[model samples]
Target: MSFFAGNISYNTKLDFKTISNPAAFYLTNLEADLDKNKIVILDNSHAFAFKVPGDIFKTVKLPKDNWLSFSYSLNFRWDRSNTYWHSNFFLYLKRANRFFPVIEPILKKNGVPDDMKYLCVAESGFTHAVSPAGASGFWQFMKGTAENYGLKINEEVDERYHIQKSTEAACRYLKDLYKSYGSWALVAAAYNMGQGGLDKQLKVQKVNNYYDLMLNDETARYVFRILAIKIIFEHPRQYGFNFLPRQLYTRIPVDEIKVDTTITDLAGFALDMGINYKILRIFNPWIRQNQLTVNQDQPVILSVPKEGYREMEKLSGAFEYTLSADTTL
Candidate 1:
């Protein structure tokens, strides 16, 4: 009998009575075992499709002294099995299709490793989520840190919610962290727990390696969580996430409108642009309030749909623009 999947053809000679489930047999034969190490490349970048063995830490860019133990494997298994985590992971994957194009170029321009994009996934699930600790946006920069990285934050405009600017800031921040620690793993740890805290732990425990250091629960699981996410994202079908190309979220084309002056009434401005206020905010989440106050020295660029107001109308059905500015529609 011959069974075909993708580009591979399987020829098997076995009696049907020999197996309890022919479907299970074929599936078992078709999929590579998760225990085995195999190399998979995407966009010319190397990644392991399966778990990394103890012997080959360098393949995944782990430090030379690194060891892959049961703890790391357990974390990977835990995420793979957790339904809640899978749900979020699926959403993150879909959102990545929309956001990665905007983010990856900035990372490449800054010479940061492309894999660092997964850290953004671990941080915010590719959404502008505000953490309980007040860390906000895709890269999850706090108010002070966001400002320090050149992201403007105020009542009117918080550039932390701006995808391009925040990603650029993240590249700068990641490069700085890498310079300080000289290890991408340690840079990720510092990003999660703050450099000061990671530095304190390194000094107290007298360890330079992230894997070897004893740290807080969140910090300890941090890198492993990122790794688990990376593995699942790389091998989605193996982990049971199946999606057609059409099912994935896509980026919407936009036209940039530069405004050097303050808009006292954003709703009126949206009406002028032939889009609703809600649609305006949907594309430009960095605009915090109903009104955007722009400085002449620093112009704010807003994105409207490239297909014009019709695209915006498609996103949000036609509604009466008669609501008061303070109505909060």
Candidate 2:
């Protein structure tokens, strides 16, 4: 392993020509190459010490209820591997800056713990992903669950894609889970596996603590994933993610425009806003189709660029893809 310009790279060549279990071989390949200090490095050069670092609990700001067992020490080493220690983690750090500001206040106001926000990182890394089981959005709320949490999901609109609404719905779910399990760690585990599944395990094992229960691999790693995100993002530079403010995605402001009437053309609406259909959709993702039809007593909610908040009407002509030279916002 060599260090260059704050980046670490692992330079190991393996000829797996004679290996049958190559998948298993690759995961354990680096274990044999650790230095005397037990420093393990991955292809991305993210380095971690396997020999349980000093004051593990304090390093991670672990809750008093959580036990920093030997298993967790090992988990932390794995979490700090290239996957979490390198560019993947760096990108998450950047994206978190964009999404967390919007999520934090809601979580706080809804009486959920701040650490729970890391579940967003574990579920989707602040990106849009569709799970094979049909979970969607940054929160990965299942269709039924999203509906239960007040997120709209239908042929016309999927509020799961709406950042603010989805995060609010996620807060609702987390707070609900917290009511059942007073521990954040337990809540994290239950979030991965359903509440019923987790409750069964708790009863069978006679253990109320998340750290003590035996669980499936995904559920076992769920809280650890949240903890890993919390630790790495808390001290990102220490993990080699020295991202600049400009490198992060911008959290642009938007103004909501209420519409009760049906609109046949989204492109024309975008043109009227001095933008394009793409930009309009990017701002208001819940408007899923080219046309929006409001319910009898419901109004269609649309958010548009809030920058400058200029002239009431007058800014329409031949719509150019580029912004006008003198136009501000």
Candidate 3:
């Protein structure tokens, strides 16, 4: 009796109509209902999961946002062949509540699109801890590029891991890329491949749109992946993800202290602050060394979590104790 139960006859074969029927999309995939309150994951490897609401199938639209839809076709796609292809997007959506709220003010302050916040996911899965061909930080800037964008890269510290500083740097970079390409989609493509590379490809292929260009696999799929993320994130219920507000990542309270001078031992510093060294590193991951040495007076802000989550907040802080270049030396 589900309105969604119909088979689409495509060519010679019948395509099971998961998307065509709204009621079927909701009822048949009983396990995927948005209100289920279960942490369902698109992939086991990427550590991406969402807590579904118990009554998601019964509900039509997201609670507050009407701009978002419940249409299955617009909402979900089967990417069983490639998982990470959507991890960049899924992880971003799961973490949007925490990191995104913080990113909005920064983007607004710098005059960028609210949508551009997804660039972090496109760049490095909102993980300040990442290493891809020497790119670092959530924005995924190389050492040279990070320096060009006014981020300090050094042994004692790398500001690329600093969310605010790195986001500011990303805003500047994105704005410039926008000025050059004049399209946000193209600008996103250019982020993966350099502007010069994009220019060469465009000229060679005689195509300006991101989808048309023949380029490296990573760059080719980049824009689509972002779009996919946007679609899934904007319509989680449609894609079979459901979650209550409390189930998603929440903002943590923190206290910031400025250290203009270097500390001989970060471990000792944490003890003095009445917290463990492990906790210290959790908040200020840019701290690469056990001791911070300030050769020439430079100030760095350290964020210490209020309590109870640093040891347990594994997913919230994306990268912990991952290898990264120390530009401070």
Candidate 4:
């Protein structure tokens, strides 16, 4: 198959031996021009073309009263068009499938708007990431804020890395923000830039609306970034992200084990549980060290594969002995 662009003709044959770089070849030749005005003919029998839709922005939902003007459009297009941003957005979409099931319920139970989950996508890309400013987790809660929102943060454990607990803390924090601002848009802005900064901006600008108030560059673009993520996530194919169901990440099913006692050797404990140290930490990233110190009053819950421990043990072939589930050391 051959396609013509201007006067240049390119063959779309999948001959790997002839093509030195398959990726570059496909990107340079096979991808559509995306030009609104010109249509390229493929061979002599088939032709196809697409243009940017007239009501593209209107098709995706945004908050009715909030700004969806030029600023929002710019951010949306940047997210859709920039190669780096587009790849990350595709990854965020795949990760969302693994996380939203865990996050959305917490948002709903706390009365936060369902759309607010995208704020998390904006915050940390649904990963347990720690910002240089000390914000951590999928919700990106800082140390003091995470503590204030009832997340346990300390040397041995940081619930900021715990998805469910951190999401709960986020819901609490978001509810408080909503109480103060009475607008989800402002709540999002406040979430990005501290409540104090946003308050100062509102007071200085004498404007209650997020769109009306001027903020620092990061804070100014924060909500719009979130809105863009929401739009792209809702309509991924429209923004050029395509994936099969199997290509996306998924939540692993696990059994929660309650521990009220300390374990001195986490690696040994993992082997005793018929798994490995890496798998244990993968499921429980909040475990900061090789040892877990527990108090009887506040037991820590650990997640393990529900029915695959034996399979994992066989696959690993490294365990010499297996202890009872009640073993804490």
Candidate 2 runs further than 4 Å off: 1-56, 59-81, 307-329
Candidate that scores best on lDDT: 1
Predicted structure 2, TM vs. truth: 0.74
Backbone clashes in model 4, listed as residue pairs: none
Estimated TM-score for each candidate? 0.77, 0.74, 0.69, 0.75
Model 1 residue 252 distance off true place after TM-score fit, in angstroms: 0.9
lDDT of 2 by residue, 68-146 (tens): 6635644654555434345566567666656777888888988888888888888987766778887877899999999
Model 4: lDDT equals 0.69
- For residues 1-329, write the lDDT of model 3, one tens digit per residue: 00111221111111233344211122333333434433333332333233232443453333233223222222232252024344344345556766776787999999998777766776777676556477888888888888998988766778888888889999999999999888887899889888899999999999766645678977766665665555455554554343334445556678888888878988889978767777787678777778887644666678886655444444354433455545221
Judge candidate 2 against the unseen true structure and give its global Cα lDDT, from 0 to 1: 0.66
Name the regions of candidate 3 deviating beyond 4 angstroms.
Answer: 1-91, 295-297, 307-329
TM-score of 4: 0.75
User: Which 10-residue window of candidate 3 scores lowest in summed lDDT?
Assistant: 1-10
CA RMSD, predictions in order = 11.0, 12.6, 10.9, 10.6
In the range 156-226, model 4's lDDT, one tens digit per residue, is 67888788999888999989999998988899999998999889989888988877776787877777677
Name the weakest run of 10 consecutive residues (lDDT summed) in model 4: 318-327
